[model samples]
Target: MSTVPKREEVAKEFQWELEHIFESEKAWDQEYDQVKALIPQLAAFQGKLSSAAEVNKCFELEDTLSISLERLYVYANMRLHQNMANTKYQALSEKARKINVSASEALSFITPEILALTNDELDALINNEQLKKYRHSLEEMKRSKAHILTQAEEALMAQVSNISSSPNNIFSMLNNADMKFPKVKNEKGVEVELTHGTYIQFLESKNREVRQEAFKAVYATYGSLKNTLGATFSANVNKNLFYAKARKYDSVLDMYLYGDNVPTSVYTNLIDTIHENLPLMYRYMELRKKLLGVDELHMYDLFAPLVDEFDMNITYDQAKSIVEESLQPLGEQYLSVLKEGLNSGWIDVYENEGKRSGAYSWGAYGTHPYVLLNHNDNLNSMFTLTHEMGHALHSYHSDEAQNYRDAQYPIFLAEVASTLNEALLMDYLLKKSTDPKEKLYLLTYYADQFRTTVFRQTMFAEFEKIVHERTEQGESLTPEDLSSIYYDLNVLYYGKGVKVDEDIAMEWARIPHFYTSFYVYKYATGFSAATSFSKQILDEGEPAVERYLGFLKSGGSDYPIEILKRAGVDMSSPEPIQQAMSVFEDLISQMEELVK
Candidate 1:
């Protein structure tokens, strides 16, 4: 039996250095205590914001307290992610969560108190020289003044903040800690434990029987808990709906986009444009079917190898080097920081028992970013390496260029740099490969990215819109309803040449992104924006690199749309999506030509 190693069994270097954030549990506890003490000090500034000096003082103290709280929260949660089954870290994480709620309740009064001021007073603060560092924040507060609740109401919501987040936490605990899958036979007929980290590996297996068995086993596990998963997801949707209504937003999507100031049309236009271009998706699926020579292309075949004998097995070291070389277009300083980050204690690089399943780049503002990766020696894992480092470097650059008040980039723009890294990596490999078969494989590889990131994620986005709207209209989604919605989308997206298997209906039960509602859409939009950015950088060289970096460094100082506009891609317009679709079409044409 093949099984995952325990956290202690994994080597130290592969683990992220949590010591950099908190030297010891003692250190973490001290900082947690310090942040709690400062929350009361923050609350004391409740009724004193008339003068510029007082406002500036209050803002500075709030920044200190907030950053400290962020550090505490990040450290504790990351510790838990190492092994969710670890009871000690779980308690530490919950302790961090409670303090975060307390800190939130204490600080919630600031926004309402600021909103309570007269228009002239607000305008004055926006232009106040003493508060020059916070001009953008003040402007944002003014923009959101209409939704800002009274102090008492904000405090009440803050008190219930942790309760509202219950669904996501509950799902996380169940999915990561408690969920178990029986071992399935591998391609070699050896039994291996089915895990979240290995599920994709099995799906991508060249052996069809192995793929089908893994798929059935994994979903059967999720299917057993379908009702529980459905209720959890419904609770999450209600949480969003409740907050949206409380904030006086017309819809949950509007509430989410309001932070980045993105319009609903941008969201709708993406779906509309993709719907118009889905024939390209059909064309790609047909090509896939022809290449694989399978009588029917089942859902499990989506990630199967398209071309024979073009294996790109990459070790983590090779993945790092290849990613670094691929990003050379971004210039030396970018490479320098990237290399340092890769070598430094900034990433937790392998999977252990009960570690978080997927990959993400995260860190507190002042610290270097950390990437969590469940890496395998395969082409897909290499892409994930570049993808996640893109996020880490984006965070690094933003932290370097902006103050803590503006350092974090908006979610709307978060995926741009990451996908751009992927674009560059694909471009580099295509250029380097001398073998025609390898070249064809790489082309199909990138084409599949479009299929997955753009088309597939758009489908997920549409599903969210449907489910959320249904819930908003007083329909609670049962397990059947969720599966039906997901199944219909599979038919729509892959119906032409693929089998659209029944087990795929339960696929949503395992999707972690649904927990972060409306987030899947950004993957689609970001792929488009990054395609445009990559094209510009390759064609225009230094000038484009400068603009792209400027966009990254702009952080959350401006609206995401405006930042992208200035950086040369206008996401509000459908041109980027259309351009991305055109690129996808070109890849298909190239593949058709090559096969001939």
Candidate 2:
């Protein structure tokens, strides 16, 4: 029997240098104490933020306290994820959470206080040299004055912010912690333990029997909890509605979109365009069915590998060199920084017992971005490395160029960097491959990216919009309602080429992204934008690279749509999405020709 190795058993080189953040547990504790002391100092200037000097003092102190709190929080959370069962780190994590809440409560008065001032008063205050640095922050606050509530209401809202999150928290606990899937036999007829991590591997197995069995086993567990899961999701939707209504937004979608200044038309346009172009998705599905030679393709068959895996296993070191070469269009400075990070202890490269299962690039303002990857020696893992390094490089560029206040980019713009990296890597691989089978596989993989990222996520986005609209229109969302809505969507999107299985309806119950309404659309949009950006960078070279870097360095200073516009892609219009669809269609045309 094979078991996950402990963190101690892993070589030190593969492990991340957490000591770079704080040096030791003693140092982390000292910073935690220092953060606690600063929180009170932050609250001292609360009632006196009217004058420019007072505002500057408040901003400085708040910035200091917030950055410190984030450093402490990231350190604790990363440590906890490294070994969740370790009680020492668990306690440290809990302490960090408590301090974060305290910091939130302490700074709660600041926003309402800023909103209390007249626009003219704010304009005059921001003109002072000392306070000019916060002009963007101040202007953002000023823009939201209409949505900002009274101080009393804001305080009440802040007090219950943690409570509002209970539904998502409860759902997470139920899904990640309490949920258990029954063991399913592998292709060799050996029963293996089923888990969230292993379920994807099962779905991707070459054996049809294994895929179908794992699919049934996992959903059966969720099917049993349908009512409870439905309740939690309903509560979360209503929670979104509560906030939307309170904030005076027209709908929950508007409320969510308002944060990044994305137009409602962008969301509606994606659905409209996708509806018009879904036949392309159907064509891809038909090709899949024909290639696999299945009588009827079930939903479980979607993730099976298109071509056999042979000599495609890429070691981590090989992946680094390939990624570095693939990203050469981004220029020398970008490559230099990325190479340094790849060589240094900037990534926790392999998974250990209790380590986080997925990949992410994370760090605080004062530190180099760090990545956590559970790498397996496969093409998929190779792409995951480039995807995450995409995020890390974006963070690195932003941190190097912007001040701490402006370093954090919004989630709306976050995925573009990552997906663009994927496009570059895919293009590089296609150019380098000579084997017909390998080229077919790479083209199939690229087509699948569109099928999944663009087509599938739009389906999810449409489902979210419908459910939120229903709830907003005084309809209660039940388990049957959610399942039926989701099932109908599958039929509509997948068309008549495939059978929409009954168990697939219960899929909505298992999707965690639904809890965050209107968020999935960004994945679709980001992929489209990234496709356009990658094409330009490949064709236009240095000039395109400069534009892309400028957009990354801009951070949160501008709205997401405006930022993309500066990067040579206007997301508000449908041109980018249209071009992306054309690219997908062209790939399908190329694949059909090659395979024939």
Per-residue accuracy of model 2 over 1-596 as CA lDDT, tens digit each: 54778999989988889888989989988988888888888767878989988888888988898889889999999999898888998999999999999999989888878778998998787676787668778877887887888768887888879888988899999999999999899989999999999999999999999999999998889999999999999999999999999989989999999988888999999899889898998898888898788999999999998887656989998999999999999999889988988889888988898887898999988888899999888898999999998899899988888777888899988999999999999989989989889988999889989999999999999999999999989999889999999999999999899988889989998888987778999999999999989888988999999999998788777778988998899888888888789889988887888768
* lDDT by residue for model 1 (1-596), tens: 54788889988878889888888989988888888777888766779987788899999998998888888889989999999989998998899889888878888778878888998999999898989999999999999987878778988988989899899999999999999999999989999999998999998889999999999898889899999999999999999999999999999999988888989999999999998898899889889988888999899999988887567789999999999999999998789999988888888888999999999999998888999999998999999989899999999999989999898888789889999999999989988988888889899878988998999999999999999999999987899999999999999988678899899999888888998888899989989999999988888999999999899898888889999999999988889999899889988998988877
Candidate whose lDDT is highest? 1
Highest-scoring model, TM-score = 2
How does candidate 2 fare on TM-score?
0.89
What lDDT would each prediction earn against the true structure? 0.90, 0.89
CA shift at 587, candidate 1, in angstroms? 2.7
Poorest lDDT segment (10 consecutive residues) of candidate 1: 36-45
> For candidate 2, which ten residues in a row score worst on lDDT?
124-133
The parts of candidate 1 lying over 4 Å away from their true place are 1-40, 68-106, 150-202, 209-243, 308-320, 339-381, 470-485, 501-512
Q: Can you give the lDDT of residue 267 in candidate 1?
A: 92
